[model samples]
Target: MLAERPWTGYGFESFWGTPLLLNQDQPFDRAWDIRTIVHGHNGYLDIAVLMGIPALCVAVYTFLVAPLRDYMRIPLRKENIHLGDFFMMVVLFAALNAFFESFFFHRADPVWLFFVFGMFGLRQVSLRPMAVRGRS
Candidate 1:
């Protein structure tokens, strides 16, 4: 629904309380922009956000970078990679984040969902297929 860079920030407040979305307000900057700020005051949601790190790692292997080729239950076929899948992945990650922020967090966040996802691609080890067990 909303579109903004991960680094620049993407929060509900930034969307509603800033000039970019709301009129008559100055453009947001890293500093002096109250709407872009977030705090971990929420209980379980705060913990859930922290839990995302490991979930994401598994998602990447499941959806994009299945390193253990043989053991991977249903690796996304390389030939089947599609632009839609990319967007879907981002949406899935964002939805997970939004659940925490909107439900238990009791606060909103401008989380960089795609940033860590992208980093997985950038920093991943070789994608060369490997068998977890010997060829019996």
Candidate 2:
């Protein structure tokens, strides 16, 4: 129960340490309680069914479009289109967009669409000069 001490004292430091039901005589079993089981199942189902598509879209755009934009922007030799650069761009874009969406939009899934568009727009702007210079 809520009033009972946690089996592992480590959780006692936080508000989550407080149990929902306070019955001092009841023991905290290692088995999943009804409430915990239901909540976790529902949460997993929601994420998998509702949020999975957008998350996948974000991941693909971060790995594909972002790097293509960077490649078009940087001036490199004809053979310098390395996979490392693309991978780094993907990681950077993912981290940047994740932080921005988490802190600012409070939605980590759909915000990558904005980043994808913005990156493509910026790439277009940057590509003008390179195209005119016979580079791209």
Q: Model 2: clashing residue pairs?
A: 2-21
lDDT of 1 by residue, 1-136 (tens): 2122322333322333445434445566535654444434442233334334344355445434442342233234442233324544554465455444433223343444353443343223223322344468
CA-RMSD of model 2: 13.0
**Across residues 1-136, which tens digit of lDDT does each residue of candidate 2 receive?**
2223222222312322235422224448746444332112222122223335454356446545666666566555332334334444544564454533332122454544554544554454444432223556
Q: lDDT for every model?
A: 0.39, 0.41
Query: Which regions of candidate 1 deviate over 4 angstroms?
Result: 1-81, 103-136
| Top-TM-score structure, candidate number | 2
TM-score of each: 0.20, 0.27
